[model samples]
Target: MPLTARNPNESENEQDASQSGDEKPVLIEIDHVAIAVNDLGEAIDSYRESFGAVVDHREVVDSDGVEEALLKVAESYVQLMAPTRDDSPVAKYLAKKGEGLHHIGYRVADCDEALERLKSLGHKVIDEHPRPGSRGTTVAFVHPKAIHGTLIELVQE
Candidate 1:
């Protein structure tokens, strides 16, 4: 039997039937999972020992007040973030919330376009404009206040 509609209550025709062709995923894959930690080295070492993942990239982004280590996982990465200075937001986050996942990043085709689309849908954004982020990518943060407490980062590589 073909995939036919069984229940009349299930509006099959109302679904997006036009989207049958293989549409590539808008967000290719998770760019990274950023974990804010007080000690970057320790965090990296711990992850290395536990998961056997090695750091592929490391950089100190003074603009963001963070030193990060990227651990490659297939197409994605694990970004271990630590404060470079006391005034950094990551520092403040670590001081207040201890150590854990800080934000989730969604890879977008264009940061500005994604942000604009989000704003059109009534979502509050933090970065009104795209800003230079770590790893040479343009990024923006979406305010957690509107998204049920999950801080969202939009990245364009």
Candidate 2:
């Protein structure tokens, strides 16, 4: 079934059937709120001191030239990311926009399906297919231009 908004008045059975079909709800929950920073350690420290957040997972994504520190927040995470190289996208983003909100990662049941559904809806995508992401997840990026300047990442773990 194609991805569509559930009717507010739909019966429980109807809602279940729609969601349980070939395509499920694209978004499960907000996996993380990504923040781009100049210094990952400093950002981590700030979160730690300010909000009692601690690093749950940390990884250097060589492909993206970024090092990320994931701080668990409830069922989701606050992902602090810094560019490992000056040429990385995060670095460019920092140079242009300064340290701040970078992207939002939405947990999905199927990354590939979510990506495909977005494409079929005429949304611009950065990744044509799902790729390996930080923390052992399958992920794909949808272009910011397609979503009112907010970069959206579909993450499946």
Candidate 3:
């Protein structure tokens, strides 16, 4: 049976997946997996030489004070990012955690609605609302405290 067409007790958000065949708020494709690196160039070259992952997109996001290179991986992307300034959050993250996995971006149909749902669920959020992201996408960040140590970026393209 279709998920929403069933008679199970659920809030609107719970049944939203079936309403539009959208899977679930958190059930979208892994849009990208971001990693923090000291040298964005080196990381990009390594991915290209070692894994043959070519750069699909590269942009310096001034708002975030970071430069990122998106490497196409099937339908997803391996986002290699580096801070452009010492005050950047990525720099802070690297200082605290060193170079490694930074955050996971989960593609969402509606970034605003998904963020509202997360708020309603009492999750801590970094972005109070959707903001412009690289590659012409809208995105928001859910604080890592909300889901253990895993920082989440909800992306809507």
lDDT of 3 by residue, 1-157 (tens): 4335755545446557675456554547899999999999999989989999999999999999999999989899999999999999999999998999999999998999999988987889999999999999999999999988889999999
lDDT of 2 by residue, 1-157 (tens): 3446544455455765464554556688999999999999999999989999999999999999999999998989999999999999999999999999999999999899889988988999999999999989999999999999899999999
Backbone clashes for every candidate come to: 0, 0, 0
lDDT of each: 0.86, 0.91, 0.91
C-alpha RMSD values across all candidates: 6.2, 3.2, 5.5
Ranking of predictions according to TM-score: 2, 3, 1
- Looking at candidate 2, the ten consecutive residues that score lowest on lDDT are 1-10
Top-TM-score structure, candidate number? 2
Q: What pairs collide in candidate 3?
A: none
Worst 10 residues of 1 by lDDT: 16-25
- Segments of candidate 3 deviating more than 4 angstroms: 1-25
Residue 104 of model 2: what lDDT? 98
lDDT of 1 at 81: 96
